[model samples]
Target: MFRDEKGFRPTQQIFTEVPPKYDILNRILTLNLDEGWRRKASATILEENPSRVLDLCCGTADLTMHLARSAKQSAELYGLDFSHTMLARAKEKVALFGEDRVKLIQGDAGNMPFEDEFFDAVGISFGFRNLTFENPDARLHISEVFRVLKPGGRFVVLETSQPNNRLIRAGYHFYQKYITAPIGGLLSGNRPAYDYLAHSAINYYSIPEISEVLLEAGFSKVSGQPYLLGATAIVTAIK
Candidate 1:
C-alpha cells in the first residue's frame, strides 16, 4: 500500500476487515434503502450520457455495478478504492460486466492514478463521508475529484445526511447509535469501524452544507435531492 499522511492506512484497514459483510451490513443498516439510493445516483449519472465515468471510493463496486447496468454500452466505467480487500471483492462482483467494460484500481483518493480531466462523470455512494468527515485531507480528496473530471463533467454523491426535522433527526441518531451500529458491528466483527460509521453518519453535513463544500472546491453548479426526510441525499455538482 502507498504511504499516506491523511490517515488512509487505518481507514483502509477498517474496510479491509469488513468487505465480506459490507454490502449486507449496508442493506441492513439502511433498512435496504441503500440499493435504491445507489440506483437513483446511477440514473442521475447516466442521464447526462457521459462517455467516461468513474466511481470514486467505489468500495466493493456496488455503485459501479449499478452504473454498468444502467449506462450505455459505449460508456467506459472505472471503480477505485484504497482497500485491496474491498477491491478484490469488487473485482469479483464487477467481472460480470467484463474487464473491457469496467476497470478497478487501488489507490488513495487524495492522490488518484488518473490524469487530470480524465473522466466525464464521477459518482460516489455511501463513501464520501470517509473522505470528508474529520479528515485533515478532505480538501485534497475533493480537489482530486475536481482534477480528474472534465470542465463540464458532473460529480454525483449519494451519502448520508443530517435531517432538518428535529424529531426525525433525533430518531435517526438514536437508531444509528442503539440499533444499527451494534448490529453492524456484531455481524461484521468490526465494532470500532461500525462505531465510527455511526458517529460520522449521525454528525455528517446537511445537503446545503455539502453543496457549499462543492462550490468552495470550484464546482460551477451544485444541486441536491433529499431522501428519507433528509436523512440521506444525492448531491450533484458540475465541474
Candidate 2:
C-alpha cells in the first residue's frame, strides 16, 4: 500500500488546499530560511556528482530546482509528488527555472515506478515527516527508497528535528503551538492544515531514529547533522 493510504483523507485535503499559498506561507513561516535549507540539501546531493536524481515528495519542486541548477545540464532530475495541485505548481516553477531536463511525476512515493538501482541520488525535504505519521513500520517507504537507489547511492533527507537544547525546544514548541498555525491559516485559509503542519513538525522522529530506519532498510552507511540549532537536519544514508 502507498504510504499515503495510511494517511487519512484529511492529509490529502490539506496538501491540496495549501498549494496556492504553499510557497508564500512556507517563506513567511520559516522566515525564509527554507531556501537556505534547500541549498544545503541540494549541495549535499550534488557532491556525489549524480547523473540521475530523484526528489521524492518534491512539493513544488523547490529543492529539485536547486539541485537542477547545481548539477550538470546533462543530468536528469525527476520529481515525484502525490498531490496533483502541488505537482501542477511544481511544473510551472520547473519550467520557470529553465530546467528542461527535470521531469515531474505524479505518484505515490511508497510505490515508485522506477526500476531497481535507477537513481544515483534521492532526496526529500519537509515531506518526509508526513510519510512517518501513519507509517509506523516505515519499511514501505524506506524499502522503496533503498530499492530505487544504486548500490552506494545516497538518500539525503532534510527535515525538522527536536532541538537539542531544552530552552530552545520549549521555544520551538511554543512557536509551533501558538504562532505557526495561525500564521499559516492566515496565508492559506486552512486552519486545520496549518495545525497539522505544526503538530507534525514538533512531533516528528529524531535524527538518530531515522538513521536506524535507513540502516534497517538495507542502507550501508548513515550519517546525520543538525542545522539551525537542531531545529532541522540533513541525514544521508548510502545504499
Candidate 1 residue 137 Cα shift, in angstroms, is 0.2
Look at candidate 2 and tell me the lDDT of residue 157: 95
In model 2, residue pairs whose N, Cα or C atoms come closer than 3 Å (at least 3 residues apart or on different chains), thus clashing, are none
User: What are the lDDT figures for the candidates, one per model?
Assistant: 0.88, 0.84
* Weakest ten-residue segment in model 2 by summed lDDT: 1-10
TM-score of each: 0.94, 0.93
- Clash counts for all predictions: 0, 0
Q: Write the per-residue lDDT of candidate 1 for residues 1-239, one digit (tens) a residue.
A: 22235645345557776556778878888899989999999999888899999999888899999999999999899999888888889888888978788989999999999999999999999889989988889999999999999999999999999899899999999998999779977887766677777888888999999999999999978999999999999999999
Model 2 lDDT tens row, 13-43: 7677555667887888888999999999999
Off by over 4 Å in 2: 1-9, 97-99
